[model samples]
Target: MTRQLRRPPETQDLSRESPTVSVVLLSYNRPDYLRQAVASIRAQSYRSIELIVVDNPSPSSAEIAETVAAQGNVRLIRSSVNSGYAGGMNRGIESAAGRYIYLTEDDIVLDKDCIRHLVEYAKERQSGGLVSPVMYNKTEGTIRCAGGEFALGAVYRRRTHGEGERDTGQFARPFNVTYIDGATMFARADLFRRLGGFREEYFMYVEAVEFCARALKAEQTLTVIPRARVYHFEPPADANASANF
Candidate 1:
């Protein structure tokens, strides 16, 4: 009888060495928008990410959560009452269990490297409490937010850059910034908990700005990483996107 080749021992278990990152998104009644957002997230280059989607008591949101959950790496949370942006995000953030937590919108489409780039930038900076990227408007192909600065009077925290190509170089470099739109924000979980998350009183607008301001007051560094850009899918062309916000 021919000698049988020795077989290698079978491995019993396998585990990933990298830490997990949690992406928390808040959704209302926009099921279609949630689908697009989930699709983009499922295509991320990073494999160790947990997606947490919180529905703010929308009548049709259960279906949205089901559809998103089908894609894997997703957790759905539904509220009994319609909590606005701040309240919903608070719930999502509390459920996230990753070293880094990404606060984002259900209507945005992310680039493949968006999360990876943000994590890398945060690691390199070593002191960034919050990091956000340049956001582009899907409808007009224009720049939405790229490092805002506050000025005196009406120009305070104004977005000075022009639309489209005119705002190209504004985000070419990374530095400490005044405010980052909550539409896409990556923050260290530890730091986030320490800060107690967003001030829920704002309800909607200005909450993000207030968070950054508080972070600054506490001497926590907030940086804008230019390499990671995301598409902010605002209102369609048929509607007045400006008034919608």
Candidate 2:
């Protein structure tokens, strides 16, 4: 407790100071999912944001470009070569122009106030490197991942409480978490640049965990805001990626 209060103050600014955010969505061959994802961004209550969709080496990605063009503030980039997840995200971040940058998968659907809540939380913690919401499985309505814990050999992402479980009194508290799910994450642009972007080495698995380790090692906090919520489209029997882990 004393140690927490003794932490140094951060110098970064996180006000609604500006509503601009460059939201990046990286996709491969999932055009249908991309459409819904782009639409979710377009529907954000925070209107000053722009959308960047990176279509990585898909034969039909051009059609995604055409579809995104219909929306005024969207910028679509189709990569000639497949850069996988990390590379595609890097390309999108390079092109993003906003004080804050957000990343999400093409299958997510955001609530209108999603960005609003994230921005507000970030503002409260000026040096926060990453912030995310409590995510529920879109299909099952079960909690997916709220935040994570780094211990032993790997980080563990915790899911929701079991049915009929009583709400604890700690529900209102906002605390530092080990890492946020990359499915929906927000960060200040400068902090992101300082972190050197997501590591492209791991390809898919453990990217967020690695990034969180780096951020926490630097004394930057990763927070979870319960008020900000989203639904993750994880199919019931969807198994974790094998080789990526």
Candidate 3:
């Protein structure tokens, strides 16, 4: 089951804008972080954006709806079941009307110019299929993920670049990468729709990796624009979590 909160009348004018960027923010059981993330997106230097909030059956569903309602120009989609990250993102993407889609998680805050930088870079590099910003740990101020690639092996493994390093301008230059972190991804709307969004069978983990791999196989270039940055408030790993999938 799914419910959609209507957007305010004032937000209707957003469709008139050319080349609008739709931001699909996936939230699950974290209302406070959702508020902060929404605030950061609203504060972006790029103003032509439409925000879509997908609540993945959060326990705080009412609070999530309230937060989204308080922020005008936001469309809220509430799911009856927790479909994990991939499904939630797909829901938002299906309703997106922008030429560009910016997929993000609830606990990350974007830099004011983050979207602007991404849009500019994407336009400059027409062949780039996916572009993502450099992510830093919000509390630790250390690199979370600059960009990443898979290790050549029979099993799936990833090698993240500059995972725990300080901002020393080493990964500052924009370059091609094997995959972009799922926390914050920017790409053309058509590309995502054409690829049928993410494979929901995996539920949460490795969806981004598989999506990127498919995109690469389709001859799309994945890249990281280091100038654009986002701060991620990543939670501690669950002790019970396993890689059995």
Misplaced by over 4 Å in model 1 are 1-17, 151-167, 236-245
lDDT of 3 by residue, 1-245 (tens): 12232222233223433468899998877788889999999999889998999888745789999999999999999987777887888888878877788999887899999999998888776745999999999899999998888843311588888898999899858998887887778898778877777878767667888888878878998889999999988553222221111
Candidate 2: misplaced stretches above 4 Å? Answer: 1-16, 152-172, 236-245
- The TM-score values for the models, in the order shown, are 0.83, 0.81, 0.88
Q: What value of lDDT does candidate 2 attain over all alpha carbons?
A: 0.69
User: Cα deviation in Å at residue 155, candidate 2?
Assistant: 5.6
What order do you get sorting by TM-score, best first?
3, 1, 2
User: What TM-score does candidate 2 get on C-alpha atoms?
Assistant: 0.81
Tens-digit lDDT track for model 1 on 1-245?
11112211332112234457788888777777788888888898977888888888665667876777687768888887865777777787777777778988767889898988887777666644788877888777788777676532332355623335545575678877667787777887767766777776666666777777777777877677778878877654223222222
Q: Distance from true position, residue 10, model 3, in Å?
A: 16
* Tens digits of lDDT, candidate 2, 23-107: 8887765667667777877888877786788877665577777777876667788887775667777777777767788888776
For each candidate in turn, give its C-alpha RMSD to the true structure in angstroms.
11.7, 7.2, 4.9
lDDT of 1 at 94: 74
Query: Of the pair 1 and 2, which is ahead by lDDT?
Result: 1
| Residue pairs with backbone atoms closer than 3 Å in model 2 (clashes) | none
Scored by Cα lDDT, where does model 3 land?
0.81
